[model samples]
Target: MLDKAELGKRIKKVRESKHLTLKNIEAAAGISATHISEIERGKTSPTLGALMKISKALGKDPAHFIEEVELNDVSLVTLEDRIVEKLGSAGTMENLTTSIPGGKLQARFIRLSPGKTLDEHPHTHYGNEAALVLSGKILFTVDGEKYETSQGDAVYYNGLEEHSYENISKKDDATMLWVSTERGVS
Candidate 1:
């Protein structure tokens, strides 16, 4: 069974954290102020679609509303615990090794295969991030500034820069560790 009251509290907390008012959320979600109030006060439950709208209004993932993390019971993760999902050759992605999302933070071990190049995507966020190359070499262009990194080298930036990386060596794959926050403009 769903805990409507708890969910309401979570919703209100997220909204307040983002410094949003009901009027602003209503404008973005097309939901009524009264309805939003009822949901926040635990007087009513929103349908999945309504919840989605509220999450979108807060610039959060819809899944956040239903996520009830019991961190106390979360055990330290081993290699076997990592949930790996291939984003395919489209975008290089690896499983987040941590058992928890680190809340607003994201940590991952990503690999860029040889001869692979990624498209430029701009980032906007509350803070910045750094990337450390573990093995091989990669050419990076951040905010149009070209850079290169070899094993044991690291790159730090605002991450708000439009950036991309390409494996420069055809013989060796590039391995990197990425740490960034999830609260960012995509």
Candidate 2:
């Protein structure tokens, strides 16, 4: 059965994940905030037209709200289809996890070029972060403190601390599997 409340919840989750409010949806969808509130609260069901408008406002497809999804034990991402992005002079990063609706964790494979840092400066965010060195050596700095790590070494820390890593190897790239809890849509 298609539950109106569950549909509303899904819509609300996506909107919140995107850091949007009812008023934001209102302006983008051309629907009243009060009406959207009613829809989100499951006090009423939105018409297909209104749902379409809301989905568009949230940058989601209408089916995302209404489709029935079977609970799956695993999600897969193939090598060929992996999302890859260059980090400028820092090297490259490859997404290791498939994007799933309401997923909480994200993993990535980071290849840090020799003498390059993961970011130009230290960064901080909410949640937890951990990494396992796959190759070469890295200098991991957190909150002004430094730790030297080599292949097979693992590190975990609170993401609230300012942290960054650099490939200490002068002639080779350093690789690591980085994992963190997702704060929201990035």
Every candidate's lDDT = 0.75, 0.86
Candidate 1: residue 17 lDDT (0-100): 84
Instruction: Please state every model's RMSD to the true fold in angstroms.
Output: 9.4, 11.2
Residue 6 of model 2, lDDT score: 88
lDDT of 1 at 18: 83
TM-score of 1: 0.56
> Model 2, which residues run further than 4 Å from truth?
1-73, 184-186
Writing each residue's lDDT as its tens digit, candidate 1 over 69-111 gives 6222134656777766554562356656343423555677777
Candidate with best lDDT: 2
Error of 2 at 7 (Å): 2.9
- The TM-score that candidate 2 achieves is 0.62
Model 2 clashing residue pairs (backbone): none
Rate residue 2 of model 2 by lDDT: 58
After superposing candidate 1, which stretches have Cα over 4 Å from the reference? 1-67, 72-75, 90-92, 97-102, 120-126
